[model samples]
Target: MAEKGRPRAFDRAAALRRAMVTFWELGYEGTKLTDLTAAMGINSASLYNTFGSKERLYREAVALYDRTAGSATNRALRGAPTARAAVEAMLRGNVDTFADPETPSGCMIVLSATNCSHQNRKVAEHLAEWRRTSVAELEKRLERAVEEGELEPGTDVAAIAAFYATILHGLSIEARDGVPLERLRSTVDHAVALWDSLVRQPAGRG
Candidate 1:
């Protein structure tokens, strides 16, 4: 043969998972190239050849987090019987995630790349889009609730969704700040308790 490329040596899936955890813990700009290589158990050349660039690898890590860590919220939203129940389940899932000993505390999408600098502002915007999408999901669920008569016709779906999304994003910061799981659960309970008033009919409206 005139030439043959060498076979790849590492487990790519396993390596990507490790890289995801590294980025989850250290964030985008805070993570050095050496950090990725070390955590991934791969060399610099392999990192470049496989992942293309640090930013690309970071993007993949965030996507992986959305697929994995975010499963809890997705499951809760999909499985609960009522919109109110779904909201509680989603918030409670955050408490469980924050307390989980195996993974980094707080949400990866909310925490990992949010404060990127002007030179890397796109990374921050990427995460902001994810937060926006989450609010949309909540709004969609609430709309279904209103259509099904579980909520009043006058319910402010957008406001309710945006409010819960704010609490969801805030939980990430609180957990990252080292708040205890018990305290986090209490915060979620307080938010959950507000749903009745939030969706209630105003004054003379139905």
Candidate 2:
């Protein structure tokens, strides 16, 4: 057999972006090698050579998603004025990102490999860790809000963070199921209003 020719120098980052979108649209189990190769516009040998294996490729794709589509929530969390505003921004950002016409509808970490078999349990675990980190960050922000007199002193920061985290996960699922952006934005507004009602008052005030 003849030796294979030199592998073409296609754009690695561009290929990864394509892979990220593919994984976002189709869960790990739902995606196939052929689908990946086709989406990446690379042949099987090049795909294997560039990304090692399908599992590794999926992992890399998720990381890319974290830095790209999955980044809007983090940006909103950091950029908003108050803790409640931050949470609202995060949820609203999720709606815009998930509902964008350019990319897939759901979150890459949440919808990808969510319920795999034992052999692929590690993938699920990996995604779960990302969620745990996000929740922890939100809790830290909520706690800071309490310290800074933005939130009620008695507020349960952990519980509040957990509640919103759950809400974001549900929103991901709903967005994937074709929920309209306007409805999701309405939900975010309502959630933030709930937070506003529970906000801290000045000392000695009613």
Clashes of each: 0, 0
Can you give the TM-score per candidate against the true fold? 0.92, 0.90
- Stretches off by above 4 angstroms in model 2 are 1-4, 197-206
lDDT of each: 0.86, 0.84
Residues 1-206 of candidate 2: C-alpha lDDT, one tens digit per residue: 54589777789999998988888888998888998889999998999999999889989998888887899778877787888888888888887887898888878888988889999999899999998999999888888888988877877777678778988998889899999998888887777777754444333342
Native-referenced Cα lDDT, model 2: 0.84
Q: Work out candidate 1's RMSD over C-alphas.
A: 2.9
**Residue 6 error for model 2, in Å?**
1.6
Native-to-model Cα distance after best TM-score fit, residue 199 in candidate 2, in Å: 5.5
